[model samples]
Target: MTTDTIITARGLTKTFTVRKAVVEAVTDLDLDVQRGELVAFLGPNGAGKSTSLRMLTTLLPPTSGTATVVGHDIARDPAGVRRRIGYIGQGTSAGHNQRVRDELLSQGAFYGMGRRAAATRADELLESLDLAPLATRKVLGLSGGQKRRLDIALGLIHSPELLFLDEPSTGLDPQSRANLWQHILDLRREHGTTIFVTTHFLEEADLFAERVLVMDHGRMIADDTAGNLKTTLAGDVITLGFASEADARAAAARAGGTAAGSSLSLTVDHGELVLPRLLRELDSVTSATLRQPTLDDVFLALTGRSLREDAATSKEEINA
Candidate 1:
């Protein structure tokens, strides 16, 4: 690994025996994340996203292969890896009864921080995450968004170089999600922390992440910028509505597009340039609609299924 590489993995695999049947949770995953990059890991449920993270974070050992996190070999020196990285899991990590500031202080103590240092760090996080007003509030009394912010504070108690977040904003409302992300962006901007996160919200990844890694069926399939993936894999979609089904079919034949009912749809690299030409060439088009591709479109093109459908399904299937 290079000096600037925060994480490096090759042939990382994980397996489990479920009712006497072997299930591959993750397979031959190879990845490299540089320092100060915000990477979003995307996958359908039961697609091994969580399992891969568990192995990399040293919560679970890889069945085979090797990885280094924060300059420490995960298999040979788990303690070293754990000491340098922060992990905020799907579930809340704070105790319900403990006060927020005390919870953070306790987390610092767990990381071997002295009492005075832990207190100082806790105060800093409380202010940075906007949790200072609620520092003495009981954990259970805070709202869902407040709890998530506290979770982030606990993860950063040791000021680790890298942070791994698993569905950090899954259950928050739209406004709360936006608030949480703003704090995350500020953290990265202020501290230059490398963030590797898995999120169900595709828009969050598209808007904030520097790179996106897509996984399916226990294997890494695609990795690139969200813009590049949408442009190359999904492209722009143009829908032309005709006066009749026959007119639609004729237009499809002339334009090399697909015809369904009274509509002709075409996928092109640049819809703005192609749509006007197609409209001038075809006289039967009664209406035209040009749509830009989203990250969901990229997922559908890659997997032959919509990610929204997969995301709506029960998350319990991928608990491993």
Candidate 2:
């Protein structure tokens, strides 16, 4: 592993035997995560996102391949890797009957912190995550958002250099999601913590992360910035409406676009530049509109499916 790389994995693979059938959870994966980078890992259900995170966090060993996290080999030195990383899974970590402050303090103590130091760190985290007012409240009495906040506090009690968050904002309301994101950003800004997160929320990944890693069917499909993926994979969609169907067909023929009834649609890399040139050439254009490609568009272009739909379907299957 390089000095700046906090995580390095090569040829990683994991498989499970389920009811006499084999399931490949991750396959021949290679990855590197640099220090202080806030990266989002995105995929559908059973797409290896969580599997990869578990391998990297030393929670689950890969069946084959090698990985080094925080300068320690994942298989050979899991304790070393664990000491330098904090993992907050999908569910809350605090005990239901414990006070929020006491839970945090207990976490610090588990890391071998002195009573005074644990109390100090507990108070600091409560204030930072906006859980100070509810510090004395029992964990079971707290709302969903508050419980998640306490989970984060529990993960950070030891101030690990790297943090792994699995569906951190999965069940939060929009307002609570906003608040959680703010606190997460604040943690990165103040502590330079390397954050590796898995989320189903497309907009959250698009707006918050510096880089995105997309996976499908146990394999990594794409790795790049959200803007780059949208620009390169699924360019801007340009739609032009004409007064007559014949005019739309003519415009489509001239612009190499697809025509449907009275509208011509074409995708171009730079809509701003293409729109002006197109309008000048096509005199019969009655209306023109440009729609910028989003991260979902990139996914659709790559896999012929939508991540949003996958998430909804996954939820439905779980309920069923």
List model 1 lDDT by residue over 1-320, tens digit each: 22399899999999998989999999999999999999999987778888989999999999999999999999999999999999999898899999999899889999999999999999999998889999999999999999999999999999988999998998899998999899889888888999999876789999999799998888988999998999999999999999999999999889987999999999998899999999999998999999999899999999998889988884654556
Report how far off residue 276 is in candidate 2 (Å). Answer: 3.0
Candidate 2, residue 96: lDDT: 95
Residue by residue across 1-320, what tens digits does model 2's lDDT show?
22399889999999888778878889999999999999999888778888888899888889999999989999999989888899998888999999999898888888888999999999999988889999899999999999999999999999999999998998899999999999899999988999999987889889999899988888999999999999999999999999999999888888988999999999899898999999999999999999999888988998999988897786521100
Structure candidate 2, residue pairs in collision: none
Error of 2 at 271 (Å): 1.3
- The lDDT per prediction is 0.92, 0.90
What lDDT, from 0 to 1, does candidate 2 have? 0.90
Give the number of the best model, judged by TM-score: 2
Q: Which candidate should be chosen as best, given lDDT against the real structure?
A: 1
